[model samples]
Target: MLGELAEKGVRVTVEAEELLKSREADLELIVKLIGLQKPLISKEDVESLLKPPELRPVEVVPAAAFAPLAKEFSSDIRLNHTLDVTGKSRTRGEVENFISYFRNRYERLSRMLRRNGTVQTDLADVRKRLNERVRVVVLISDKKETKKGNLLFEVEDMTGSFKVVVSQSRYNEKILDKARGVILDDVVAITGKVLEPYIIAEEIEWPDLPVVREKSRSENDVATAYLSDIHFGSRYFLEKKLQSFVEWLHGRGEARELAGKVKYLVIAGDVVDGIGVYPNQEKELLVKDIHQQYAMFDDFIASLPDYIEVIAAPGNHDAVRRGEPQPALGKDLVSSDITLVGNPSSLSLEGVKHLVYHGTSIDSMISSIPGTAYAHPEKVMVEYLKRRHLSPIYGGNLIIPENIDYMVIDEPPDVFHCGHVHKNGYVQYRNTLVINSGTFQDRTDFQVKQGHVPTPALVPVYEMKHGRLRTLDFNY
Candidate 1:
């Protein structure tokens, strides 16, 4: 090996050679080391090639515009794997835990409805009274449209489940329309007269999001750029456009002024398009190997401004388990400076709580909810807020049923950030800024067939000081 390296004009230090021998360097590894074109190979060079690089803390700009703002603000950001319950439950435990979790959600929502003069009656407690009227709140477990046009719902509570009927005659067009929009696994308040073996529902009520009249904002000026679904390594990856955005972050053009004020860059999910993600995926891949795909992604991150803290989470297409609450990318895939958090993570930036989810479950909600469409993603996000859960509908999305029920949004965040539908959406729901970060990957063949024209290279910058959300387009 020494003679071979000498032939290649590369000199290996005595220490490097001793270290390699101690580590029992294989022939292939020795050949690879010799390939490193250097007149002299030092201990550090050999060590770097052999071991993973040391992780460094995210660089903080001393003269950052938000430095003073951060002093007054304290972040209780949930660190990586802080409250993860994935891979920590048995089949029976998962079933029992979720049942209990949903039941708790039901009780909490029912109490809120009760405060509004709507009394909740358990399915088992309701009895058919002849010539008497009955109105109660119930959780709808199942619903079916009858051939004669009446709506039949199988609702349940902790006690039991029962059948509720909504006749087209008693209810007006508006009420009937509402009944038709009723999705299963929703907690609702039904009102009307009670008949034999059936409680005719005159009105159906959803556990709606409460109106928040006042919203809070930071006293000092600070902002964060929201991005997701870059899908690097795919043929559709918008490399030039994304490069432009990165340049803008490092101070370029009119965006330079805004760039200086950006304290953080939050990437929600789908950082890279993995291998074998879907059928015929290889046909659209520019980088065939998953490691190479991540290498390209890491290079992109390396070009980003070190002063800006970059936080990333995984999505369905990421090289993680095909389930919600996905773990962070492997050490080889992502750089150390970037904070790799779990899917459906809760982030605290200067004490401002922001819930970041990849929005995989949004697909299920779009199909299940009537008024919802992919064109208006923020509308569906409202359902998660109303339920105070990230992915509430079980069996809709591929979620690992953990014991702690991490899907439940225990507390309202100042910002609810999600991305996955490849569209941009923003709205203020009950003082929470709900935003769906757009994608970097342009329209692919699959997306074209699905009628989705992704709004690529658009980043939503949330200004905490002003409590304002704005989108910056870099497609040009």
Candidate 2:
């Protein structure tokens, strides 16, 4: 019915959408609404326009299911080894290991930049050409702005370090704009004129993904539903709406037809709001016991439809290590039949590759990168793809500095799914579908202070074969 209204040039709020699905509302009113010609219909609009012939008792629907009714679900889903960090974590946090970690990251990302047909020279030998144009790949060690508003970056390769400056007056407007988004520790190729000590940058090239990669389509017509930032134990958790979503998966009203085609469900992260995550966090939590919170999560997963294969990862709020390449949720945390992987895990479903990250680094990217905010995380995600690495800024998040930089996006997944900001955003960049599934938890006091508006209970369903997307709001 929401889609029907959308076709007729009307958008409905989730609350208004819920009323339309209730016994109090009817489809005939949709025709009346179209006649009214209001582009957006809020809940109050429905209440004012909708008048029953007489007052009667309303049928109160159950808020949640007592148990998950699993059905026979058989789908082609396999976990890929390259991205999962489960038992392969190797790091001592020593200075020597940290050196190895950054060097390894540089090698991988610099190789990607070299593939762009630019002959990269080491910083030690870049000056041999003298005043000529030269290309060099280096990690940004420090950055500052000159009094004249020129951008100066102290960058270095393994061999040596040098200063590269992008003058606001001398360089093109595009180069200055791109330089504004550059953060520390970013491995990128800078092409410029070697002027004595400084390299006057003219062009900066990141290890971005190719624009023409084939977007793999599934042979089957199954769709995948994504849920994230559930925060099950939080006081702000939208239990009723989540319950409505679950019931919808089991053939509830309105968008029931699309529900049947959903073969896989991915929960990006924040399965439970962990203890002591922040100051005064305990006061906002309903279930203070952490294990009991997981118990509730286990019960919820156990209740899911059998045909919908569920794969989940941890978030900063989960009972896992707060690091970029976090391991999977411990077996002791869950007992339900589901695939448990690391924070950022890769998998293949219906022949399409999916990179599932809890998206903890989104905050860092948003703060460091210009033109990024909590509202449009898909844009920030594109920066990750452009840089060919997640968490490019080292101190942005708690990274363990493992020998291997698991944060590097070595292989581009066909679909990238993430959720941490609690705001839903979807965009397809360079044939890769990027989706931030949003959150199931409602706005909190912290979010209010941060000016973050969460699109709670708004879920996205993706069609595997056709790349079609449909969103269902369960904030009813």
lDDT tens digits, residue span 180-255, model 1: 7777677777876667578877777665556754555655566788999999889999999999988777666455
User: Candidate 1, TM-score vs. the true structure?
Assistant: 0.77
Candidate 2 lDDT over 1-476, as tens digits, reads: 66677677888888988887655424687778877677778888888777666778899987543232223335888888777788988887899879999998999999998884768889999779788999999999999989988999999998999999999874378899889989999999999999978999999988899978988887777789998999989999888888888888887667555777788899999999989998999999999999999998988877767778889899999998887789999989987888898978889898889988888889889888889999998898889899988889998989988888888888888999999989999998998999999988989999999888989999999888888988898876
Clashing residue pairs in all predictions, respectively, total 0, 4
In terms of lDDT, the poorest run of 10 residues in model 1 is 66-75
Model 1: lDDT equals 0.76
Best by TM-score: 2
Question: Which parts of model 1 have CA positions greater than 4 angstroms off?
Answer: 1-118, 128-137
